[model samples]
Target: MFFWKIKKNPFDYLQKSFFFSCKPDVPSVNPFKTSKLISSYFKLGKIREAQKLFDEMTDKNVVSWSVVIHGYAINGFHSKSVELFSQMRILGFAPNSYTVVGVLVCARGLPDLVLGKSVHGVTVKSGFESNSVVGTALLGMYAECGNIFDSCKLFEGMKNPSIVSCNAMLAGYIDNELFEEGVLLFNRLRMSGFIPGESTMLTVVQGSVALESRIVAQSIHGLVVKLGLDSDMSVNNSILDLYSCCKDLDAAKKVFDMMECKDVISWTTMMGLLVNLEYAVDALNLFLKMKASKVNHDAVVIMNLVLACTVLGDLRRGRQVHSQAVICGIEYDLPLANSLITMYAKRGELQSSKTIFNQMTQKSLVSWTAIISGCLQNGHPREAMKLFMEVWVSENYSLDSALIVSALTASGVVAAFELCQQLHCYSLKAGFSHYRSVQNSVISAYANSGCMDFAQSVFEEMGCLQDLVSWNAIINGYGMNSQGEAALALYHKMRKSRGDIDRFTYSCILGACSHSGLITDGLMIFNEMVEENEVMPCQEHYGCIVDLLARAGCLSEASGFVDDCFEVMGPNALRALLSGCVLHGNVELAEVVAKKLFEQDPEESGHVVLLSNVYASVGRFQNAETLRTRMDKQRLMKNPGISSLGESSYDFG
Candidate 1:
């Protein structure tokens, strides 16, 4: 019967139709009959049914024992399999090569390596140690049990360690986060002329990603194609993961688009790439596309969708995804709820975020941090501080690094310098004052709270020096205080330092250049960034560049630069360009940019006002009136002009 037709490969699953050909009394037959039927049931993942028949067997042989052992081992019941192995031994049924492999797999979950060593002894006594299948199994068991030393020892002792054994060791090193060791092992495997298969490629990619070695990742990708392993799903997914983790969204997309067969994991990975890249709209569209393709969306995809909606500030989409989360029974899952609240808060919907926060049955530190951070983002610093204090009083919660950072950020908002100092002392006691992110936040908090002296002191005490973000925080702090020359000096020192210059650093430096009207210096830094720094200019950088050029009265140069730097045109760039044209009274250029800005974001009232200001500055009263009339007709209110609000008091407020 067609139902009885089984694929010759042992790895293949039994056909569903084969149930029709199964005899009703098959379980009551002889030992061979029971073993075959049990093996079939085991292969189909009917573990309980297989276990019932095995329990009924009056005279079980080694084959029947091996079958049950393998079923338990493969199904992740490692302890039960090991216990059954002892039972088989008591019954005087010696384990064969396959049974030895099964027993080794079962020994993985054992805490002590003694059981695994005993299994190794059994394999040797059974003369199955020489079998490559059993050898790989033993190697994998040692690796999984964190006995890397023993695993490598086993591989070295083998007359010929197969590619499977090599891949297992490589994967073990990666899982242990010994990236350098994994890379070296992979190199040694290549030198030994044992061709790396897809699994090896995946292991190497995992190592590269963990190390954040983009060059190594790219090389591994090349090796994948060179070795013809790119078609392997595991290899492709690893490549995708590496690119996403590296923040190389373009590279990730290239790998994603190159895949001929995209599984749900692949789709989820692509969605993750979009989220990490901050292409939330595109990510949501891709997720909808995945659903349209009939691919099952897992929890990861759902989380990505929630993130995308949050970014787009599309409360409607967020609510739709929330409904889906309810259907999936994860809506109130603490992490998911925390994420939803964060998204809503970022979109300025503090009410919805607060409601969700209040509804959580169980709250983690993440939940508290999310709601507190949301309050900070939604301009409720007092509310944020209240929540932070509540979290502090609740002894059930632990203050993680993120929680402290958010509290410090809120402290900066309220200019609660004394509270910030207390938090700083707490951070020191917690030993997180030395943590990079925590230290960076401390510096930013001190700088923003007008505690420049404290900020400088913290900056000087950082043992590992400063990262790009630290430098940015200091430079931006200096810029905020109108200390342009000081900011410029810091920028020069940063450029001279051997630190990486991210977009934030470039953006800060440009702000300094704009403030100081350092046209020559700004152009120099911009050129250096594009040429030497190789930090791709995003909208922030482009805005800074345009502002610097415009402040120097080079409106035409700034306009031309904007046209060229049109890859990721954002509101800031348009504002800078329009402001520059208005400052110079370049009516033609202002008209062009304002029209484009209005077209792109008509709801933003600043563009029309900039055009009106340009017209008025150029003595084009008629044009100014015309623009005003247009604004009135469109019900667009001009943004308030820069306030010369006097600091009557030298207080922090």
Candidate 2:
């Protein structure tokens, strides 16, 4: 009886033998033939016809009810199907495992977990819980309802779970972000000799993607080839995505190249990943290849293409993508609009950015963030702060960490110190202060506003939870305030605390020593940066050391260091040495430095003006006049020095 009941198809047994010998009240038509016709109508999407025929059935058995219920469920008439199941129960017709499975599908569709649990009770009451077909349906229903724990319990209670149940449970695990456990179950099932079908392999590949395990990805790749599913588009797309997630671009490209029938998903996946992995130019090339092919572009693909353009800083191509997006009819896409705003802002095309931003009928938080960041980037801090105030005042949109950080940056640039304090308090009230980014931004804002006492207070309140940025902010804050001794003390204290010091930390500390004329400490720190921190001195590091030595009237030693380490020392080091020459009345050495400067980059007029001024300071008016004539001939214009005249104004352009 158990083996016989395991047969899933309701009409297959009837074809072999008359399982339902119906007594036709109307003798002209056969009831069994009528039931088969109902199923055919349902399959053909003729639900009204199927239901009309079902209503005509006077002698309805369990098979009759199950067929109509299953038809209605599969045809997307879930509420009606569930109503029929309830009516069948009230009519005293006992539901078999097949009937239970049909109603279970409806329960999942309606997302009625209460109905599903009640059905589980009925399945148990009818002893149909042991049936594989019923068990798999129940497993799927529970998994669909986000009740994986109950699904797992139900599976364990089953006598012998089927492959369908296993697959359902694996999907459940993936849904709940339990990929480690899902992979383990897959391996156990694979080792137990259950040959996964195409869908199972696809799910396994998805789980491996989440795990980001190279071993699992490669293993699945081998299985795909071994099982001859390499040509399966869905499976191939998933495998391609998995390889990219694992950071194995070579493997991802290989899979993409080997795809027999690449689809839009394949192109989108590679396009997005290439852009994300900083291979923006390659992504653009891939988009060109995709355009050359038969596949048409979608909104997501266009957005990715825009992103590639943005990353490459190719404003011409970015505008072209914008044009093509309209031609493709996705100009109204919100993500594309936001991407365009960011692209234009980054490329210094603020007018184009604001046009896209203003035309947007509906703006997301990203929209606000992008435009505000653009304002700040283009030196329009007043505009950024005004927009930020609107969001804060209206309370229409909830501010996220990124948005708040942008606002904090704007406030630091132009807003008063009190405004920065208020933003900090608001962040704390809104519970965004816990985010490391927000905390760091607040600290930097306070430090930049020349409020080290507040910066130090915030840093101390963070206690042991302080990040590298926090330490750097406070340390650099001290240095900027001309409290060089305090900055050096904090640096030593940071070392004692075993805090990780990045290259920025060295830059800050060296700048502190440079400002205070602590030449010995600055030299020792630069040596330690190379020997202990193993940090290769970048241009900033070299510039800071040159500034330190030059400021201390050590022109000879500073010039020698420039000669020795000339490779890394670019314009910054040269500028620092030239400033030292002007400060110390060394016209001879300034001439040599100016010669090297012209050899490297002659276009810079400020350095040349400094050398001319040095000659003029020693009463060499002829040389100074000669230099000014040469400057005019070369059309070398230096930016006029600007002084800050409170907010919303600069003394000069």
Candidate 3:
């Protein structure tokens, strides 16, 4: 016992074992055991282990080969699976229906169609093409590969296809965005007396949603209910989504309430519908109810909640939602984070918005545009321009029309003329100048930057591509630049064209009349807008009319107009009259308009200043000083006027 025994090698011990000892004499166990282990490994997602075991097998049967091939295909290793299928065939192992299906699965994801074609050839050679299951798989593979032509041929060749096969083809059409084809096929299936399954009906409903046909959607809903498929959560959700897309909020809510077991998707879809319909308050209240019901809030729900808070401008609630977003661990989600930035910026909390933007690890073009637009809106145009430059220098971001528009706006605000021209050049080079929105933004930027000539040139170049916005922008530019004649001419031309004149169009022309003292033209156009164009005059139109009359030395007529429309006129109308009074030295009317303005908004120091200036212009210095004293007593401070040069310097006092 004390003697040192010789160390036995594990290899020798394995050789003496029952399996290896009978090697070459008995049937080999390695192939069978190894194949089973490979299948188990494949099931457990140990793909490398399965592959290694499969490679070591000396005799692979069709079953073992099919396992590896199917496993690789389904697991998204499509190329590796296709290679194994070829190896199996090279080994002279005849293919079965299962093998053919596995190969077809591999073919579904092949970027190169040649391999799929080869697999198809093998299926035909193996005489497994007649198998319904195999045929369906082939049809699906062709569809998934975007070979609709081949898929259609394969589908037509199938004699008396099963419902599953028909659904596969139908789904292919829908997935390819061939909604009309899908609808035609659905009708044919119905005519053939084929009762569609949940999948088939879902596809049809999707087609209906894409078509945005309310009648078709309603018919599909009725069919779903008749088929007793409305109870299915997926079908119900699809119905709800269809109604939401069509803006049928009542029908969507009805479908939502009918759902027996509402999932998170159901709740989120309903909340999104409310938000989309501009019922922000209702959306927030529903979200609170959802929280009270112990339903979990996902990123989508949080984003909706943030949007609601943004719309309401409820900073307290917005902050609460931000905290909840952090707790949910989705605060860093790009879209949700971008939404948070928008919420804070809209609330006038630029510091908080910047903090959120800085904390983002990954920023999208939309994210950049959101913060830049926020900066511009919050009166930080210089900062916004700087951010735009940073975005431009970064190669990771591509400039979209939205970002371009935002940057152009910032450039206009800062009076960065050179920068504006550079952006215009870049837009042309990037091929974004052709985009109607970008073109409009460029026009507005040039006009706001005191380049009406460039703005007009862009407008004239738009030709037939010019939309209503283009006309409005150029007309407004002319009005702002005191080119009232040009503005009126453009308005007349727009009227002659196919462009439908809107309220904004009328407002711009009226503004031109006010600036150029075209009282008769203003009154005539106002009548045309109402009677001919059927455009209802809004508060702005009323203000324009009052200004037009006041500027034309018809102070009495302006006052009478104001009295006539006093019920509908806001402070802006009175303020417009006050401005005209200041211009024409009508102190008496100025006093009346200022008093009305004060009653409307007590804190508006501009109205006080304007009236004081009118008094000073009329040599009533004592009255002007008295007004200044009253302003001091009330602690009202006039907002500083901002003027900018071509560079970054701005004068503010």
Candidate 4:
């Protein structure tokens, strides 16, 4: 039944019947018709029929072997094609350039670099290394196998490398994210007086975005313009993508507007750019215009619209787009589905998000990541942890670095140190322990959970990949848990590393000094912040210094500092001083602070309490009583503090 299920080759059976019944020469009488029949069967994707005709041939040569190998390779049966190549070799057929290219492509699909290299040796022995077509295939095979070393070796050894070979190496570098190398080769190719083809242009444009090389990207753009390749739609689309990825939205829009016939991809790219730049209303208007003009909406367009709905916070319109996606039958697209999940999550509709996520027949890494992040962002940290754990348990779902990072964030909420340990182990097993994002998450998770030793260890291990966020996380963690000395040490280390410290890092270190009463270090950091770092002190930065002075019992100094900077003091800075007065029982400063606080927010009963308490401490009972009477008239009561039975009880309920 399995054999009969395949379409039968009628002519082959007839020819066999004729050879058996009447005469063998009858079949040999019409060679042209027989070859056409065999070719037709192969074209129809009837591989079994084609194989049956091959078996019926009294004698087979390189031509028959080429047909089967090319057919199998084209039909995606790469393993079978490689097997056929071996069989043809055993049959004493000389492998030509065509046969080698076909089998090289099949070898590229092996997913095993060792096997690909072994087959590459065969191509070298076959004397097809000098052939441009065969050389390109070999180079592509090495590149696709993730063996860029072998690819570069092959390219360098070539006596007269064609444009195809150069382009292949350039593309290989790009695929590996070696954008600088790709750009250099592109320049060399241009300087060597070799004109780039369409593929070469696309590769360079893509590499430009990958490397964020604006100058090289502009050079490519200029070349395209000068060569009149801008009119080509494919080249224009690539240029548009390059501009968008570079965050040059203005340039991207210029390219889009200049296109004579804008496709759905162009419009979608523009809409995405608008959404990224927070022009939600403009993005929505563009979507409406696209729909009004009857441009064909593909999966990408729907994904962009879903992202727009998420940004605009228009849940009503989000549902409409979801409905349109369902009606258009593009709802099954993973990216679109993921975008919908994110949209619902952003709107605080966890139930709707979960429902859509459950309905997906096809789930990808992105789809799973969306739902996991949605749970975390929408205040369902436990659910996020649950989904993340499930993802780790499944083998088909590769553990992405982002998934681990998101889970670490959720785990740190309850200080799930055990879960953090599991992620660390997973990172080691996946050989991504040094991944920057993963290492940052480990440091942050440890730091937030008060595991300072682990945080420091992770930070120390991060030799070079520590960006501003990593340093800020560790510094802020130390400040939060009252490790002022350690925080200051890290800030100095960051400065030594030539790291450009931002306001967050400074604010964190200043806060540490305020709480720990490090007056000298605080002053030094403050001076450096203003003069050396050249970071204009925000109100928060200034407030930290005032609070630090107040904590150190430098009341007159604090008051002088506040007076000197009264013009620059924001409302929060004034409140910080009022808090300092309450801490130090300074009724004189409290009196001046009360007037500022009351003017800032007359309804704040806490400031009244602060003023009354300050007055009571100074034996001015009548003033204190008058403050109480004003509080009664305002009808605002101070919030009483509540005590829990046990600290551990808070974790569960």
lDDT of 2 at 97: 79
Error of 2 at 85 (Å): 7.3
Model 4 lDDT tens row, 1-653:
63553347756766666656775355453444444566678789998998888778766667667777877777778988888998998988988777777787787776557767776777778877788888888888888888898898889888888878888899889988888888887887788788887888988888888866566667788999988889888899988888877778778888988999878878888888888887888888998888898898898888888888888899999999899999999887888888999999999998988998999888888888889899888877767888887887898888788887888887776577777777778887988777888888888787767788888888878878778888988888788778899898888988998657788888989998888888999999899778874678988988898888877878788878888998887766666777777777888888887798788788878788878877787788999999999889889877553222322213231
Stretches > 4 Å off in candidate 4:
1-49, 52-59, 111-130, 147-166, 428-433, 484-503, 506-653
lDDT of each: 0.83, 0.87, 0.87, 0.81
Worst 10 residues of 4 by lDDT: 642-651
Question: What is the TM-score of each predicted model, taking all chains together?
Answer: 0.62, 0.73, 0.81, 0.73
Q: What clash count goes with each model? A: 0, 0, 0, 0
State the weakest 10-residue window (summed lDDT) of model 1: 641-650
Root-mean-square deviation (CA) per prediction: 13.4, 11.8, 5.1, 8.9
Stronger candidate by TM-score (2 vs 3): 3
Residue 95, model 1: lDDT of 89
Candidate 3, backbone clash total = 0
| Residue 43 of model 4, lDDT score | 85
- Collision pairs in model 3: none
lDDT of candidate 3? 0.87
Arrange candidates by TM-score, descending. 3, 4, 2, 1
| Superposed model 2: Cα runs more than 4 Å off | 1-119, 122-128, 131-134, 389-399, 414-435, 449-470, 493-501, 515-517, 530-533, 546-653
Show pairs that collide, candidate 4: none
